[model samples]
Target: MKNLALFDLDHTLLPIDSDYEWGQFLVRIGAVDPVEFKRSNDAFFAQYQAGTLDPVEYLEFALGTLARFPRPQLDAMHAQFMREVIEPALLPQARKLLQDHLDAGDLVCIITATNRFVTAPIAKALGVEHLIAAVPEEDEHGNLTGKLLGSPTSGPGKVTHTHAWLEQIGTPLDGFGRSHFYSDSHNDIPLLSVVTHPVATNPNAALSAHATSLGWPLLQLFND
Candidate 1:
């Protein structure tokens, strides 16, 4: 069986938070109100870093922004985000690590708490085929519905979601010869614990402490 490799998107593979950056991108482009939108965005991000994030509440705000625009406009804006914001943050070491996994014929997947709408293209750009992320609902007309369709992939849900995704793909979690999860946040500890090899990739202070205590490998993909 192929070895399973799971990577957290924000702060693990990339140095910045993609979801938060996307919000700031919108604000910078005048697509969102500068004051109130930014205030709420910063507030939610603070909660996330503090490990007290309410995924549902953040999702409501994030998805609602998507719901306000047509798919075409969102796509255009995201394309700009990729060029202006994400492109700069992409590190050679991160790309190399992903490529090494692919070369080893591992089942590489980016499992993130960010909604699929925001993270899908980023995953595609990184050349990863499979992605497990928060699901956003769409209307029959192909417009965003401003609602979450399934369990949020944060905290403990990451473990369950990974299991479900693996099962759906005909591979049980225990079936792998070796499974690995790389993450930066303590919120992903549940998933990290379940994997055979838990790597702290550019970990935050909390995760750094936890991983250090567990003797998990620390991987710093960026110089800074």
Candidate 2:
């Protein structure tokens, strides 16, 4: 009877939204037009918070830059992005929480709406082996297509992808003695409802109210 631990990356383990920050990072580095990119990025982030985000449209916007740059340069840029943007957000409390799950030998996975291109390195940095993210397609030339390869791991798709991933790994959601999901948005409610322990972590107003009504546990990883 193994325990399963699932985490949402943005606003759950991290106090900030990594996807939106990555967009701002590109803007800061002059890789993209500051005015235009920021405008679209902020809009999509707002839609995400509202739980009305269309994952496909968001990915088209987010991954468009990936197609314009060569892999080597993209890799280097991401390296800088990690150091300048992500490193500071990897707070002690979040690290300790991840460590606790690892030390307990729980089957840990990060299930996020963020794309694989942006999140893979972050997952590696966090020492997480399993990630379910919106996967971008690569061409025969090994170039990004700026399109999703499968269903976006978001909203209802979170439950679908998690179940599919678990099936592939030979462990269904109910197979574990206990399953835990930590998330911050109402967008994740579908998956949260299915898990044995659903933690409203750094929850937004909607999720806070929902969790409170349901008597779910609330955790603030970034509480000062």
Candidate 3:
């Protein structure tokens, strides 16, 4: 049987929330009104941390940036984002964690609630081949529609998406002798509960408490 290692992209691996950083990136580039965008962005992130975020509303705010610019322009900005913002957050410990799983012949993948447009490059930069994220819809003209194409890969949705992805690849979760999931949010509890190994990396208050109760391993990849 194969071994599978799954990682959450945001606080778990990167030490910061990618979706919130993407919003800040747009504001820094003058793509949106700083005052209004920051306010909304902070609010959305707060709700996310509280485990009460409405996925649709958060996507409306985050994916809306893609619709405002052409694909080429957005791509270029994302490249800059990778260099300036995300690169610094990719700690050596996180790389080692991923490498350890790979060395053990485990298939590694990132599962994030963030939209694909924002996380795809980040995953590539981190040398991850597979990524499961919210799909941002595109229009007939190949432009972003500022909408989600399917269910958001968050909370219980992560479990659903993981099963669907496995089915598409002609492998069932049971085919894996061991399955590990590293995450930082309480929202990830549903998926974590079902995995063979559930690691809480830099967990939030709720997740920290839950992990303690469950006796799950706690990790801090960002410590300098």
Candidate 4:
């Protein structure tokens, strides 16, 4: 009998949203030209939230943002960003909560809409054992080919991916016996519905309403 814990990144584990903050950070660090960066970033984000952008195109465009930097430089930048920016974004309580789960020996996994290449390091940093994230298609030469291996992980896609992972682990959908999921957006409703304990963390309006209606617990992390 195992207890499974599925965590949402961005607003759930961290107090801030990663995608928006990453764009702003790139501008500040001169990684991108401010105006053009913001314009492209905003548009892509809009399309992503609306579920219109294909995973491949989205990942290629995002990776292209790092085109000027070689892998080594980008890796160093990612490390710095995680230490100075991402680390600060985590709430003290949330950190402690995750630690408690780890101490209890539960299987903790991150289920996010973010692409695997971008998030794999962060997931490693967080000490999470597993990650179920959007996977970009790759070419034989190991370049990003701008395609998706599967549907983007969001809405119902979250549940779909999660169930498959569970099956792979030889754990049925309900195998956890006691399971918990934490997320911040209404967009996660499909995934929320499948969990035994669904927590709304700094939810958006729709999720807040749904949580209230379902009598699910709501948690607020940081003020901003």
Name the best candidate (by lDDT). 1
Q: Stretches of candidate 4 above 4 Å error?
A: 46-57, 66-69, 138-146
Candidate 2: where are CA atoms >4 Å away?
none
Whichever of 2 and 3 has more TM-score, that candidate is 2
Which regions in candidate 1 have their CA more than 4 angstroms from the true location?
none
The digit string of per-residue lDDT tens for model 4 on 75-163 reads 77778777878877666777777888899888999999887766777778777869999886655645555566778787788999999
> 113-144, model 1: which lDDT tens digit per residue?
99999899899999999999999999887789
For candidate 4, the lDDT comes to 0.80
Alpha carbon deviation, residue 20, candidate 3 (Å): 0.4
The candidates, ranked best first by TM-score, are 1, 2, 3, 4
RMSD of 1: 0.9
Which predicted model would earn the best TM-score?
Answer: 1
TM-score of each: 0.98, 0.97, 0.97, 0.86
lDDT of each residue in 1-224, candidate 2, tens digit only: 89999999998888889899999999999999899989999999989888888988888888787888877788899999999989998888998999999999899999999999889998899999999999988888777877678777899999999999999999999999999999999999999999999999999999999999999999988985
Extract clashing residue pairs from model 2: none
Candidates arranged by lDDT, highest first: 1, 2, 3, 4
Pairwise TM-score winner, candidates 3 and 4: 3
TM-score of 4: 0.86
lDDT by residue (tens digit), candidate 3, 1-224? 78999999999889888889889988998989999999999999989988899988788778876898888788889899989999999888999999999889898999999999999999998999999999999987777988889898999999999999999998888889999999999999999999999999888889989999999999877864
Root-mean-square deviation (CA) per prediction: 0.9, 0.9, 1.2, 2.7
What is the model-wide C-alpha lDDT for candidate 1? Answer: 0.93
TM-score of 1: 0.98
